[model samples]
Target: MQNLQGKSIAILATNGFEQSELEVPRDKLRGAGATVHVISLEPGRIKGWDKDDWGNPVDVDRTLDSVSADDYDAIVLPGGQINPDLLRVEQKALDFISKFWSDNKTVAAICHAPWLLVETGIAKGRKMTSYPSVKTDVINAGAHWQDSPVVTDQGLVTSRNPGDLDAFCEKIAEEIKEGRHERRAA
Candidate 1:
């Protein structure tokens, strides 16, 4: 595991996030020595969406109203069809995501989570991958979408689905270790 002792990471999600997508990466990042916090739209806990049903609940460590992108070293967006769809409409969420890019902090998304990336307007000109269903949206956002388990462009890391968690987590840690990237202009 990479040494991320002094690093801090934020897992951004809301109700309906894919259970595995959020839990797995959160565990892996914490195990790797980074301080991981779950930031949500509300206080208390948010429920997750499992394979075909509602999954477990994860406690929210902070609310968007109380925190900014400057609070962490990196941010992770976990995908579930409903989660990203809901998040993409919020200007606050989009602005928070934009701050990560503007600051060059690592921003990692997996599965349908890249939908939020498209809404943030940072997908343009970057190489990324997401659940097959999101390929067209990503391309439309000007990203070079690829069919792969995982793809990393600068500090932005993306993966296709839950099966890609291992590679996704690894790339996120690697990118965080390397620190901020000088993103190319959109």
Candidate 2:
């Protein structure tokens, strides 16, 4: 209904992801007519964390090693402390994100997922929002960090946490529809 038909949306996540953060957006984006694919560190499936405990399982669409930046219109990074913290340490995962930025494609990260953006070093000067705990890292990265449900600047979209999934998913859908390229990437 929101004109996202046929758009390919990719979610890059790993084990220990916040379940709601991943599920909410995945469902919302799919409902908006985008094909949502979950790309994880491994093939098969990845487990999610819900409120300090293990949650449901989500089947993986592709492994990070097999995914190419050009295959999808947008990339969503769902964060939990362990998810992004672990991903940030993987050069391949961080490199995959930078590829999206360099291509000026839509890249959205929620919660601690913004940590990947910091590691990518492509958010400098772009207005962003992330879980409050990472505000300092965002600021030090030269990005304007804010306290909000969602923040979209250029081709980058960010949200504070799972609580902001409504706004987060909506903004990501709109960004894909708008086709706004990242200015810094250009």
Q: When superposed on Cα atoms, how far off is each prediction in RMSD?
A: 0.7, 1.5
In model 2, residue pairs whose N, Cα or C atoms come closer than 3 Å (at least 3 residues apart or on different chains), thus clashing, are none
Per residue, candidate 2 scores C-alpha lDDT tens digits across 66-157 of: 88988899999999998999999999998889888888899999999999999999768889999999999999998999888899999799
The top-ranked prediction according to lDDT is 1
Clashing residue pairs in candidate 1 are none
Q: Candidate 1 lDDT (Cα, whole model)?
A: 0.94
How well is each residue in 40-84 modelled by candidate 1, as lDDT tens digits?
A: 999999999999999999999999889989989999999999999
TM-score of each: 0.98, 0.95
Best prediction by TM-score: 1
Runs in model 2 deviating more than 4 A are 182-186
